[model samples]
Target: MSLTKEAIQLITDTALVATAKALDTDMPTVVIPEGAKVVNLEAYGAFRSRFRGTFSTNSLLDFGKYVTDRAVGDARGFINQDEMTCSVLFNLGTEEAPGHADDRAVLKLKATAGYQAVQAISGRAMSQKDMSDWIEDWNSTLSAVGEDNQNISLVKAIAAVRTITVKASSESDHTVSETRASRSAMDAIEATSKETLPTSLIFSVVPFEGLQLREIILRISVITSGAQPALKLRWVGEEVQREEIAQEFKSVLQDQIGDAAALSLGAFDPK
Candidate 1:
């Protein structure tokens, strides 16, 4: 059956909420470059010829005659010799952000920890049966939440194609860095597995003021490269526009992300 408008709306809402949750959890700080330089070039060129003459016995062959004649001719024509100079300047400006180093460190630590967890899980003896079960459980959860929408279907299809490669070597005794790396890798895979709705839907739910929404959405599109598309929620006069219906969208997204987070953490009871 074709997707109903309500189904579309619900999918968009859930996707946006999930995106917002991701943003809230990882409030990425803005970064500006250290310095910028500008250079300007200006130049002028002119040509001039000079001649020296000594008194000659032959007046006809005199250099002074040639020189004086040309000078007198130019003077009669009111031509004046002049020089021109051009100047250029170079300027630089710096952009400094506060607490950037500390923020980077915290992010690095979180990523490392996540990687380690993934490594540990992968090293464990997990059978094909376990993987199949995991997939089934994930699908069932989505189905139970009325997420049979097109977006969810697409996500499931994509996830089915994903292969979780495990190393034969034991990962039980991993270094702190290795453990963090493992967890980080798994987190990335999990995020990749959930690509249902378009990115526009994600932006619709972001907590941005109306004027700022467009700019932020543009930024997100650039960063994500349209991996997750979102929709625009517009308003006209006193009436709420359907095309701009984002309140419900945000709510649904939040719920979906919460559910996904719980599942990833193994906090959700499958029973």
Candidate 2:
């Protein structure tokens, strides 16, 4: 089934309104701004696959668009306005779609962009010496447990600081690439630190591809204050998720290619 322009516009307007709500900001009233632009407004329709007589197939539909805007300020934006975008996709699948038969729709609103300006703030301040001391403490804790006893010993270290809290400042002018890299770095640090004590780390980022910057927090809770920890990662934003990430990644790839094949690929990916 094909969607009409009016239908598409209505969907776009609703998605845009939803985007504003997710960003916790009001919709633009007058000027569109220098860097601001609506990237795409389109819809998709899915059909069921049944060759036999009147077998009821499924129809899955979605509407999405991205907005890019430049950040204003003196600080360098890690992600340029070129990197930010807004998107909304809804799954119109019904009960026939396997496990989610009863689940009618899955609506998603995401802001994927870059932040060039890094904000400066104060939180739990930890000096280099403090980090060193924590590391030493962790090592000592590990040594207390027999080296041969890996499993339970590791657990013990994790449990030692289940409530040990560390403060971190939000990132300034962060791009998606920079944010991902930062997260990867933190993950590495957590992995190494967990060898001795329970560790918790948090980081925030603003992608240049979208309007809002997303804050991500990761927690590693040591069960029983000594076991190896269980990890939990949370992302706080207007519209940020796995599917949205995938869509944005695909868009970036298409822009980089800018060829016939790339256009074809973009066609398949849509907005």
Top TM-score hit: 2
**Taking the tens digit of each residue's C-alpha lDDT, what string does model 1 give over 1-271?**
7999878877766665455422222233222222211211112213211222222221112322332333321111110111011010011111352221110000000112222232233324333345335335434222211133234352443243243232222224334673464322221212222323222111122121211122111111111123332212221121232123234333332332232211111111112
Best by lDDT: 2
lDDT of 2 by residue, 1-271 (tens): 9999878777766666555432222322321222334322222214322111211111111211111111111111011112322121122122464221221111122332212211111122333334334434434222322234233343454444333433333434434673464332231112233235433323345433322344433333322222333333223342444346455545653443223121222111122
List runs of model 2 lying over 4 Å from the truth. 1-200, 204-214, 225-240, 262-271
Runs in model 1 lying further than 4 Å from the true structure? 1-129, 143-271
Quote the positional error of residue 185 for candidate 1 in Å. Answer: 20
**Would you list the C-alpha lDDT of every candidate in the order shown?**
0.25, 0.31
What C-alpha lDDT, on a 0 to 100 scale, does residue 88 get in candidate 1?
Answer: 9
